[model samples]
Each structure stands twice: as structure tokens, then as C-alpha cells.
Target: MLSTGGVVVVLAASVVVVGSVDRGATDSGLTGAPSTTATTQTEVRRVDLAQPFAGTAAAGWQDGAAGVVVPVPTPLAGFSAEQVAGALTQVRDVLITARLDPEVLYGHDLDRLAARFSERDRADVHTNKGYRTAIAPGSTLLGVPAKVAGTMTAKAGRPGELLVDTSYAFAYAFRPPDPERVNDPLHIISVVRVRTQYGFYDDRWDATGLTALDWSSYSYSVDCAAAEAGFLAPSLGKGGKPDLDAGDAERDAFDPAAPMATESTC
Candidate 1:
């Protein structure tokens, strides 16, 4: 659990976003669908205020290290235990491989880091004029810590949906003359995270063989229930701008079949 003075709120906007590439990212980690591959066993490691990025409240994270498990739910049914295990292992391997790729991404294919997304995932990639874009090659980066400590929580979304939340505390160090100066400030982390909301989603979204109902949720720590509550900050407070920018544009001007837009039916 995040033991900072308290949990503060950080608006979802103004923060760098990534994932699925279709629905974009939500402060609560709910991106239309296809959140990611949720297979790894989650183990939460609460921080001790000594870790980097531990002071902020809205970050819903505190000091210390954490191992985060970003879960991507699948919705298919009828699977032997072996099939489920095999599928998860494959997903894990691919995630690890993503690091080796100069692009720093993960998905079903490896072409131009496009493998970071699946076919069904592409369905939701349709740009509704939401300022969508993919990560440039080598532009993606992460802190694969040797001893990553983290926090996590799960909640209800829109009645039946479940939300798994995780907060990160990252501290990267370099050996050099001015290590102390550059090291401390270089640690960039969100005081809060998107409490990802998912459901018994049994479809193409999941790379793992596990399906809805079969979907198992885990995280770095279960104690995050309170720490990350209400972490999804407000969207852009546009104050009633062109709310129908995409709707108006696509409603008449843009073709629904444009390759840039992705989608699928329930």
C-alpha cells in the first residue's frame, strides 16, 4: 500500500501515455479494450520512503521498489491448464523481447514494433481525432529494475468490470563523477497510475489463452486497494471545446473505413 502522507490525485492528461495504441491510454488504465497480456504472477513490494518518486500523493506511489504486472485480459473459452500456461509464458517472453527491440514495445507481431498490437487490437486503433500516434522506433524506454518493488489494487468498473491498479517507484543510477547530482533528479515517475478497469473480457484482446471468467488478476501488491483508489485523474478540462471534433469530422467528412481507425463489435 502507498504509505505516503496520503493519496493525491493526478489528472490523467498532461502525462505521457502508451499502450494498445488504438484506444490510447486512460488515467484509470482502461483503454477501450485490449489493455495488455495479463499472465505474470504479481508480487507487490511496498516502498519505505527511501525509494525515488515516493513523495507525491496523487502518484498513489511511495518510496521503495516494485515489480509491476500489467495485465491484458483475454475472452476466449475452453482451455486446458497446459494451454493457459503455455500462452502466458509466450507472452512473457515477448514482453522481455520487446526490451531487446530498439523500439521497446510488445505485441503479436515484430514488424516495426507493430507486433506490439494484435489484429483485434488494430480494430480499436481508428483515430477519432483524439490526437493518436504510435511510439517512434527507439523512442520507447523503461526502467527494467533488477529489484523492482511496486504496489497494486483491483476494483469494480461500471458494476461488473474489475480494475487492477499499480503504482511505480523508479530509481535509475549511473556510475560517474557527478552520479549523485544527475541520478536523483533523473528518476521520473507518476505520483499516481491509472486503476485499469477490465471485465470478463473473452475475445481477441488477450494474447494469453485465458479467457473472460478465466481471466486472473494479480499485481505487485494487493495492499494497494487503498493506496491507488481513485487514481484515474480527470481528462482534459477543455471547458466545453469542440466536443464533437471527431464525431463531427467522422460523422460526415471522414470515412469510417480509413485504415488509421481501428474497432470491433461486442
Candidate 2:
């Protein structure tokens, strides 16, 4: 359990490896490759907040909720095809509401997101410090849409439960209070990779609704101070670069297929 503002949210300490039944490819259009091709000479261009992803790995990622593509649902051992489909849809809705919604991200409002969880889990959703990426008070996101790319899968859990797993990388472009002062795109952009497992229970389980059973995430190019205080602020706001040493050296924050980081690398 992780404590946030004196509230405890039960989060898995390690990644959950659920055996998945292949239901064909998902609607996600990711090619598992960087959108921009590498060139012999690096091109230098001025950072434009409006076109924040112009020169980054997320340049071709889908905008906002479009990236969360649900896979075709198939019947599991104890679940019907319709049940699987409904679970997938519900999970997708939760992901969009929790991560991509401007109200939750910029306004720090969790009402819509918390409503997606079971009654028992709603409080956790409301109080979990890292559950959502909220911009600091002094800064605001640019009008440009956030870049997203990820995959969703489903599997059977226990006897009458469905487990939907989602993994995604979200890139947000922030406009500093004084945009003219920042010159590098990395300083104004932040990437957050989230991996979550949502459990849907039937009559057998005491709880009969959906709950986020596990959660893990990692953030890049963000201010350590804001992150510590449970807010997302670009590193440029603090007059420094991201603390890369806190994260895995080989991991790329923009890669959806990359493993989910267990802890925040602020």
C-alpha cells in the first residue's frame, strides 16, 4: 500500500504477469519503431510548443484517447465474448479518463476518474498521489494534444474475474510561464509510461465491480520538486534537466513496448 495525503492505495509492488489468450492484434497503429527515421546528421530546430512532438520519438503517436486501442475480445474459459468486450471497453474508458482527460490532468479533478472504480476502490483513486499527472499551479499545457501509444490485453483471473492489462506512453507538451525563456524541447516536454491491471468480478467475488488491482508508472523530463509534491512540472521550470540517473539507462520513455518502471524516476 502506498500512502498519499494520509490515504492508502493498494498498489502492487512488482509487475503482474498474467497469461494472455491471443485475441488478434489491437487497433493501436503503433509500428514498434520510432516514427521519425534517423538521419546521418542531427537536425537542430527551434522548439515550438504548438508542435511540441515535431522532433521527438512520439512525433507519430496518436493524439489523446485515440492511442488507447482495445483489442478484439474473445471468450475466455469462464467469461463470455460479450463479457470480455464489455470489460475491454470499461478499461479503455478508465484509462482515458484517468490519464488523458484535461480536467484530471490540468485541473486535478478526479471525480470522473474515481467514479470508474468500485466503491471500495474509489477513495484510492481519489487520493493516490501518482494515479494522475497534474500540472503544477504556475504552468499550463499548450493547446497541442497529448501524444499517446499503447496496447490493451485481457485474461481470465480466478474463477469469475476478467483481468484487463493496459500499457501506454503519454507525452505532454507544457508551456512554461515564460515560453520565450526555454529553448530546448526536452525541457518543455514530459513523458509518462503507465501500466495497470484492472479486475472485473462476477457474482462469485465479494466486490462485483471493476477495480484497479495493480498500478505502476514512470515519468521523464519532469521537475523533481513538483513530482515530489505530486504534480507534473517540466524540468525547465526548475532550471535544470531531468534526473535521468534515477531511471533505467536502457529504457526509452516514449516506447510503449518497454517495461513499466516500478518507481518514479524524478
Candidate 3:
């Protein structure tokens, strides 16, 4: 399920998940067969962004041709959408650096990167096995191309937690010895958590984690077709409004079993 958060396009994933169900009539066998319980899965839609070749032009590319731009979600009471965007950008920077530059990974750079996270997450950043390989050479990782044109609402009551639910495309380039394979552009609607911290020296937000929503649960495709068909658009809320605003009672609910939109083109 999509959780609430500042609209940050970070590389990590995690989030709060809420679920719901609707009861419907079922047929029972005349032979006294057991009746099965039916449950409705939550539907989460991803908004697609237009992708033009990066670096093909002198100045249009941000993260090379695969760089992405995700739309910032509507701001919380005290947080601006731009703030969330900035935080996500920062997180993405670390992720990209972890893969491209080993200096940051081996030196005190990670310490400073860890400083961006909450105390709990800061420790995780230093200890998590995943972070250890984040800067490994010859590793291909997730990339944020550009911000899309939509927003998701942040969950209430959990002031320290930011839930981000949005769809954006991921891109990669193949290296030598491998013939270039042109597959459909991959799109994903992610549910991520960016936790906030209040320390004596600093009070700010950091991407603690990120988790991809299961596309199969909602019957979404793990390819560009789903995005091309425009089925990935953010689900609508009450009164035909995008769920980014309050009163989004009718928006898509959370689904915990949804699988991450992972694909391999090579």
C-alpha cells in the first residue's frame, strides 16, 4: 500500500502499509463443500513520466540519459514539497555515488552520508550489508530519471515517517561484450519511508528505507506496457481528485504482498 511521505525520489524503499476488504456473495456447493474466504487486494497506480534520451542533448540530461524526475508529493503541515524533493535528491545522490565512486564508500564519506539519516538509520547505513556493496565496481543500480507530474499524500500521525508512493521509470546501459538489448522501459510505483530526526546539531529528514510495491497483487505489468498504457497513473481520490490532497478516502489502499517491479533486460 502507498504510505505517506514527502515526495522524495530516493533510491531506497520502505513504507507504512494499510489494507482493506470488501465482502461479497459466494456460492456454496450443494454437497457441503467448504466455502472459501475471498479477499480484495488493494490497487495502487503509478504515474508515468515522459523520458527523452539523456546526454543526447548538451543540457537536457540530469543523471545521464537514464536520469529520472519524480513529482514531489504535496507537502505536510510543516514540510514543503520542495523539502521532500531535496531530501530524495540527496538520498539518490548517495545511492548513485555508492555505485560509481568507491572513495565515498571506503572513506569517511559514508559517515557523512550516514549523518543524513536518523540515529537508528544512521547506524544501519554503516552496518547494513546492502550499503557495503552500494559502491562496488561493475554493479548496475537503480536510477532516478526525472520527477513526474503528480503527488501522493503523506500519512498522518506518524510525523517522523514519510511515505512516498509514485511511479517513475528506471534505465540502464549495457557494457562491452554484450550486445545492446532494447527492452521496454521499466516503470515502478514505489512505497518508501523517509524518517525524520531531531538532534542537537541537526533536525532533518533522511531516507531510512525503501520498498517496491507488488505489481502482481494489483495485476500490473512489470514492463513499460503498463506505463505506456497509462494504467500506472496515480489512483484517483474522492471527488475525482488526485490522492495527493486530504480527503483522499477513496484513493488506492495499501497492499503488503505486492511484489517489487524488478526486471532484467540483459
Candidate 4:
């Protein structure tokens, strides 16, 4: 069984076989004969793997990069319309490369994402594992595109600064080593919600603080241990049962509007 937040995904139970025998004696003429019969029963359950997110909250979400929608850019107090548009576009690209890129997610590579930042900021991005998403060594994602939904908005900061805030949810569907053997979607899907703030500055700001990035996130249906190690391990991928007694704090993992979790649920 796999559980995410309050939702539980139960796989097929073990098969059970029952046998029964009957014995009776019959009298014929002067002799008596015994007759015996045996009966057997079995039970089985079926799970459909074709539609992994059919019944989940992510069912109606946008697919892959499409969900990271950037709002229409408008002129801010100190930034022009063009600058706002450019900043919004940059933030969108960063979010995609950091969270949804297959190479980054599976191979743990961050070169491309690091290139987006300045030389001074690149090192911090590389050292910070929280900037990217990764799956365990042997685990892999299902071919299905991830479900995403969120918004990006830009606002004026200080005299020469632009601030962009992004709120989004990414739902990844992972395939078990043996797809045919697993029966629950929670076993195959994990949801990650993120809240991020990015700052873009002009020459007026200090050279060392030209750009900045900060974010917080929470995940559902993911192995707590793996998450702490900076990797995502689906409940089925880890072959572990979910903590049913765990409180409702994790339920917000799927809600983009909810406040970012300040502490680990584990």
C-alpha cells in the first residue's frame, strides 16, 4: 500500500486458495461404499497502469512546461514593460530547467541550469541541491509528461531592482521496476510544490548582490529518507508503506496556494 498525504493507494492483496472435501457412505445391497469430492477457490484483483493520474488532483493540470505560465508583463515603478517581460521570461526558463529537465532530474547534472546565473552566483547554485530535482539511482520516471500548474509575477523592488515571485506544483509519475506488478497510482506518482523569489538588479545595487534566488518546497508520496538526501523516491520505488498516522501537514504538498512548509514532514 502507498499513501500520499491523506490519499492511499492500495495494491492487490495476496491470492488465497481454499479447498474443501466431502465424504459420505452409501449402502448398496449388503455393502457400504464411500464417495469423496474436493473443491477449490481462488481470488484475484486487476489494476490498470495505462492511466496513472486519471483520478488524482493533477488530472486537469497542464502538461510539462505548459503549466509554468508567466503572467502578462506590465511596467513596474522602476522597470520598463520590456524589462519586466524579460525578467518574467527568464524566471520561467529557470523554473523549467531546474525542475522539469529530464537530464537534470535523472542524471543529476546542473551545468545548463548553472549557466543561467552569473559567475559569482553559479557556484552557489551548483552547491545547493535544493535548486534541482533528482530521482534515486535505480528509479526512473514513467514516460508520461509531468503535470504542472502555477503562475509567475514580477514587481518592482528597490530603486533599481525587479522581484519575481513564482508559485507552482509539479507532479511526477514514476514507473516501478515492474509496472505490471504494482496496482496503486500513489506508488507511481509524487507531487512537489514550490514557492520561490528571484531578484534582478541593475548597476545601482552592489556588484556582489546583482541577483538572488530563494525557495521552499514540500513533496507528497515521496520517501522521507530519500528527500532528505536530495532525491525523490516514490513510495513504490522505495517498496515501503506510507505513514497513515502522519498528520495533515503534508496534504498541502499539492496546494500551490498554501504556505510553503518551513520544516520537513519526515
Best by lDDT: 2
In terms of TM-score, how similar is model 1 to the real structure?
Answer: 0.29
Could you tell me the lDDT of residue 209 within candidate 4?
Answer: 29
lDDT of each: 0.25, 0.65, 0.28, 0.63
Candidate 2 lDDT over residue span 112-163, tens digit each: 8777777766777676645677777887888788999989999987777788
Candidate 3 to truth, TM: 0.32
Q: lDDT by residue for model 1 over 123-176, one digit each (tens)?
A: 332321011112222222233232223334333333322333333322221121
Task: Give per-residue CA lDDT, model 4, range 65-131, as digits (tens).
Answer: 9999888889988778887887888788888998899887875578888877655567766665556
Runs of candidate 2 with Cα error greater than 4 angstroms are 1-45, 204-208, 237-251, 262-266
Q: How much does candidate 2 score in TM-score?
A: 0.77
Models ranked on lDDT? 2, 4, 3, 1
Worst 10 residues of 2 by lDDT: 7-16
Question: Which window of ten consecutive residues has the lowest lDDT sum in model 3?
Answer: 20-29
Give the clashing pairs for model 2: none
Quote the positional error of residue 83 for candidate 2 in Å. Answer: 0.7
TM-score: which candidate is best?
A: 2
The positional error of residue 108 in candidate 2, measured at the CA in angstroms, is 5.1
Per-model TM against the reference: 0.29, 0.77, 0.32, 0.74
- Cα lDDT of model 4 overall? 0.63
Worst 10 residues of 1 by lDDT: 214-223
Q: Output candidate 4 Cα RMSD.
A: 17.7
Name every residue pair that clashes in candidate 4: none
Judge candidate 3 against the unseen true structure and give its global Cα lDDT, from 0 to 1. Answer: 0.28
